[model samples]
Target chain A: MEAFKETLLSSFIVFENQLNGQKKSELHKLRQKAFEAFEKYGFPTRKDEDWKYTNLKPIIKHDYKIFHPKEQKLQLDEARKYFLSETDTYRIVFVDGYYASWLSLTTHHQYDICTFSALINRYPEIADEYVGKLINHGDSFTALNTAFAREGAYIFVPDNKIVDKPIEILHFTTPHALPAFQQPRSLLVLGKNSRATVIERHISLSANPVFTNSATEVFLHTGAILDHYKIQTDHYEASLIDNTVYQLQGYSVLNLTTASLGGKFVRNNPIVKLIESMAEAHLWGLTKIDSSELADHHTSIEHIAPHCQSNELYKGIFGGRSTGIFNGKVYVAPHAQKTNAFQQNNNIVLSDKATVNTKPQLEIFANDVKCSHGCTVGQMDENAMFYLRQRGIAADKARALLLLAFAGEIVDKIQLPELRQYVKRIFNQKNHIDFDFDL
Target chain B: MLKIKNLHVSVDDTPILKGISLEIKKGEIHAIMGPNGSGKSTLSNVIAGKEDYQITQGTIEFEGKDLLELSAEERAHLGIFLSFQYPVEIPGVSVTNFIKTAINENRKAKGLEPMPAKELLKLIRERMELLNMDKSFLSRSLNEGFSGGEKKRNEIFQLSMLQPKLAILDETDSGLDIDALRIVAKGVNTLRTPENAFLIITHYQRLLEYIVPDFVHVLYNGKIVKTGSKDLALALEEKGYDWIKEEVAI
Candidate 1:
C-alpha cells in the first residue's frame, strides 16, 4: 500500500479509539463500516474507469497531516473575499476542518441552519436517518470522507417553508508548515413543497499545498425546489476532489451550476438520481483553466421513475497547455417510460497545446423515452474573432470578448443577481478582461 | 482621402483582384458595381485588412499612411470601416453593448477616455431613431435571429454610430425590403458629411437612386473596366452587366 494510505488507516484507528463511549453510537458504527470499505479499496488509481483521465500519483505523494489542524482565525475583511457580502445570506464557515463560529451567521428558528457537529449532538436520530444514506458505498473517496470528516454545513427546511435568504457554506484552509489534508462533509434536506438556494465554495488563504476531499449529499422531498451553485477557484497549490450526490423525490426540481476556474488538480463527480415521477434536474457547469492546470468533471443523471426530465450542459475553455475532461452520462431505467434526458458538452481550446477530452454517454432501457446527447471540441470561432476585431477591438481584447460571451450563456442562468455579478467579477479577474455590458 | 494603385489580391494563390486601382476624395461617394465573382467584395475585404486575402502586389495609402502595414483594428482606428456583407451573430452581447465597446475601443486607440454613459446613451438613442430601430432592439443580442431587413438596418445603425471617415458598404442592400432599404438609405444620407467618403459596393442600382453617388466604377474580371458618373449606374441597371462584359472583352 502507499505510505499515505497506510498513514490514513493507522490514523483512523487512533481517531476511532479517541471516540471513547461514542464508539457504540450509530454514526460511529457507520464510520467503522466506511473505514473497512476504504481499507479494502484504498485510493483509486488511473486504472479505474471513472478516473481514467485523471492521475492521483502526484497529489497523494505528499505526507499530509490529516488528523489535527491547528486553530486558525481570520478577520472579516480578510475572509470577506469569499462571501457574497453584498447580499444577505446565512453563512456556515469552517477553517481547516474546524467550524468558525465568529465568521458564520447560522439560524435555528423555523428551519435548521448550523454545522453537522452541532446537529449531530442536538439531533442524533435526524443525523443518523440522513447522513450517509445517499452516498455510494463503492466510491472510496466518499467512504474516506464519511469515516473521518466530522464538521461541515447542515440545513433542514421543513415542509411548506420558503427560505428567502440564501445559505452559503464556505471552507477555507490555512495550512501550518506541513501539507494539510482536509475533508468536509455537508448535507441539505428539503421537506415537501419547500424552496431554498445555496452557494458552496472552497478557498485557501495561503500558498500552501492542500488536498481537500469533500462530499455533499442533497435530498429533495416531494415538490421541493433548489437552486445550488458551487464555485471552485482556490489557490494554485491546492488539489481538490469533490463528490456531490442528489436524490430527488416526486415533483422536485434541482438546478445546480458549478463554475470552476480551477487549481493545480481538480476532479468533480456529481451524481443525480430522479427516483420518483415528474422530478427534474438541470445541471450546468463552466470551467476555464490555463497553464498546466487540470479540471475534470464526470457527471451522471439517472432517471428511475416515469415522466422525469434531466437537462445537462457543460462548457469548458482551456488555454496554455491546460487539460480538461468531461464525461457525462444519462441513464433511463425500464420503468421510466416518459423520461426526457438531454445533454450537451461544448469546449473551446484556445492554444494548440491545450487539450480537451469530452464524451457523452446515454443508456436508455425504455423504448418510449427521449434521450439525446451531443459533444463538440473546437477552437474559438475565427469568423467571430474577425467580426469583433474589425470593430476597432484589438485581437486579444476581441478574443476575450468572445470567450466571455461564450461563458455568459451559463453565467446568465444564475438566478441570483448578486451571485451572477460575483461570478462575472471572477471571470474578469482570472481572464484579465473587463467586459462591461450595461445592457 | 483614399488611393489604391495597381492593387492585386489573391486567396490561396487564386487571383481575385488583378491590377485594380481607384481613388476617392473627401465629400465624394464611389459605387462599385459588378456581377457575382467579379472581386468587388474582395477589394473591400482587402481594404478592411482581412487576413485571408493576400495583397500580392498593391500600395494602398489612406490619408498618407501605408494601409497594408496596419492590422484590421488599426485600420478601423484610422477611420476605415467595412459594413460586413454578412454580420456574424454574437449571442450573448447586446447591440448597445457591442457598439459601446466598439466606440470605446476606437477612443482608446486614440488615447481618449471612454465616452460618458449619459452622452453615449443619448448618441445611441439618436442613431437608433435615424435608423427606425425600436428601443427594444438595442437590448437584443448582436444580430442573432434578426430578420434580413433588421440585420441590414442594424448595419446602417452601426455605421451611423461609428461614423467612420471612409465607410465601405458591401452588399448592404442585398437582404432588405423596400421600406428597410429606404430607412437604411436615409440613415446613410443623414450621417454623410463633407469630411468623410462612402464606398458603396452593390450589384443593383436601386440603392443608388436614394443615395446618389459621385462616380460609378464597373469591376469586370478583377479589374475596373469602366468609370462614369451616376448616369453610368442607370445605364448599367437598364442594360445589365453583359454590356460591360462585352465592353471588357473588346
Candidate 2:
C-alpha cells in the first residue's frame, strides 16, 4: 500500500512538472479541473463495473515518467513502408507524444494542421470547449490521460470543404530506460457540410513493455461525413489502451473501423453518441490474436436523439492459448424514438485451450425501436477440415485456408481498397499464410 | 492387384466382418452384394485404413504392399480411392483447389512435380464435363449446398481426376437419380483399364447393368456365402437376399 501511494504521488508530481511552463490559459484551467478529478478518483479498482474484467494494478504499480518534448528524430523511410500504397494523404508524425514537424508532410495552404501543443497555445477557445468533455472522468485511465496529455494532433476540416485525400497521423514511440508512458491525444472536428478520411496508426520501435494511453475524440457537425480508421499493430511486448468517442450531430454519418493484429495486452473502448436527429454511426473491428496475447474490445452506442441508427460488428480469431473478450452495449434513451440499432460479436477459437468471452447487450428504454444483439463462440468446422484434408491439402495448410476464409467476411467489408489490401497483407504476414486469391 | 485374406474386423469390440476373404486381379471389377448388417461398408472402410475399425485377424495387400501398415493419406498416395457414400461438405475451399491438392500430393508422393495450374484446370474441366457437372461448380465450395445427385456426380468426377488404380465405390448409387447414376457409371466405365480394378459395394443389381462386374459375391453374416457370374445378380434381384440365406443354410 505504501508503494502504491508513492507511485501515485510521483505520477502526480510528474503531471505537475509537465504543466508548469504553460501560461495562465483556458486549456490549463481544463487540465487543472481534470487533475482535480484524477486526484479524487485516483485509479479504478477491479470492483468498478467497467474494470471488472480488466485489472490495471500492474499498470498503476510502476512509476512511469511522462514523455516530454524531445529533439530526437525517427527513421521515416522505414515507417512509410507500412502505409497504404495508393492513397494520397498528408502525413503527420508524432514521436513520443510530441508532434515532430520535420517528419510531417506540408499541409495545403487552405487547410490547417496543428499539433495539440500548438492548439493549446494558439486556439484556446476550441481546446477549452472540447478537451476532457467526451472523456469519462470516472475511468482512471481516461482521467490520467487527461491530467497529463502534453501533445498530440489537432485536425479541423473547414465548413463546406472536401478533403479529397486522407490525413495520416503516425504515432511512433521510442523505448526509454524507465517504464515509459505516452498519452497521445487527437481531436478531429469536422465542420458542417464537410467530408474527410483520417487514418491514425500507433507503432512502437522496441519490444520493451511500454504503456500507450491514447484517446481520439471526433465531432462531426451537421451533414458532415467522417471515415476514421485506427490501426494498432505494435510490438508484441507493448500494452495499449485506446479510448475513442464519436459525437454526431444532425444527419451526419460516421464510419469507424479498428484493426488490432499485434500486442501483448490491448483494450479498445469505442463510444458513439448520436446527439441529434437522423444521425447514423457504423463501427466495425477485426482482430487476430495468437501466442498468449490478450485483446479486449468494449463498445457502446448511445442514441440520445430521435430517428437515429447505429450498427456494429466485431470479429476475432484466437489461436495458441490466446484469450479474447468482447462486450458491446447499445443504449436507446427514453426519448430517442424510432431508433434502429444492431450489434454482433463473433469469435473463432482455433486451439482447444484458446478461450473467448463475448457479451452483446441492448438496453432500450424507448417504446418504439428496433434493437438486436448477437454473440457466438465456436471452433472451425470439423467437417470442413476433413473435406479439405480428404482433398489432399496438408492439415496445417487446410486449417490456414479455413482461417483466412473465416476472417475474409469482415476484411472484405472494408470499402477502402488500399486499406483493405494493407490489412490483408498484415493478416497474411501475421499468419504466415498467403491468400493468393483476390477477396 | 488387390487381396484380402481371413479379414476379421471389429468396431468397438463388436465383430463386424468375420473371416472374410476376397481377391481381384488387375482389370477386374468385383461386386459385394449384401444385406444391411452384412458389413459391406465396413469392408471398404477397413481396406482404406479408417481409424476406428480394428482388424483382429486379416491381411490386406494392394499392389504387393501391406495396406494396413499405411496411413489413410499414405494409402491414398498408393492409388487407393473410396467414393464416399455420404460426401462431406467443405465451405470456402473450391472444388478445383481441392482436386489439385489431391493430385499434387499423390504426384509428390510418387517423386513427381505438382501439376501446373493451367493443366490441372483443363483436366478438371474435362472430367467435370464427363460427369455432367456444371463448370461453375468447380469454383464453388466443395460439396457445400450441393444436391444429392450433384454430390454423387462430384465423387465420380474426383475419381476420374485422381485416376486411382483401385477404386472402391461404397454405395455410390444410393442417393443418385437415374440420369445421375448413368453419368456416374459412365465416368467409372471410362476410367477402366487393364491395369486397374474396382470393388463395388451395393445391395441392388441395377448399377451392375451399367458397369458389369466379372465376379458377384453374396456377403451374408459378414462372410461370402456365394460367388457367381453376372447371372447371380439377376437371380438375387428376382428372389431377394432371403433366398441366398436359405440356400446357404440348406
- Top-scoring candidate (lDDT): 1
Quantify all predictions' global Cα lDDT against the true fold. 0.90, 0.81
Error of 1 at A153 (Å): 1.4
lDDT of 2: 0.81
Q: Pairing residues by index, what is the TM-score of model 1?
A: 0.97
Candidate 1 segments whose C-alpha is farther than 4 A from its true place: none
User: How do the residues A1-439 of candidate 2 rate in per-residue lDDT, one tens digit apiece?
Assistant: 2364456556766667657657376656656677677678776676876766766666556666654458466766766675564237777788777777767873635556667777777777888888777888766667767776767878888888887778888888776667667788878888898998888887877556677888877889999999888887777767889888889999999988888888877889988999999999988888898987878898989999999999998989998978788889889999999999988888888888887888876788999999988988888876566555554555676677777777776776677788888888888777786654554
**Model 2 chain A weakest 10-residue run by lDDT:** A1-10
TM-score against truth, every candidate: 0.97, 0.87
**DockQ for all models:** 0.75, 0.36
- The fnat of each candidate, in order, is 0.82, 0.30
- lDDT tens readout by residue for model 1, A187-235: 8999999999999888887677889999888999999999999888887
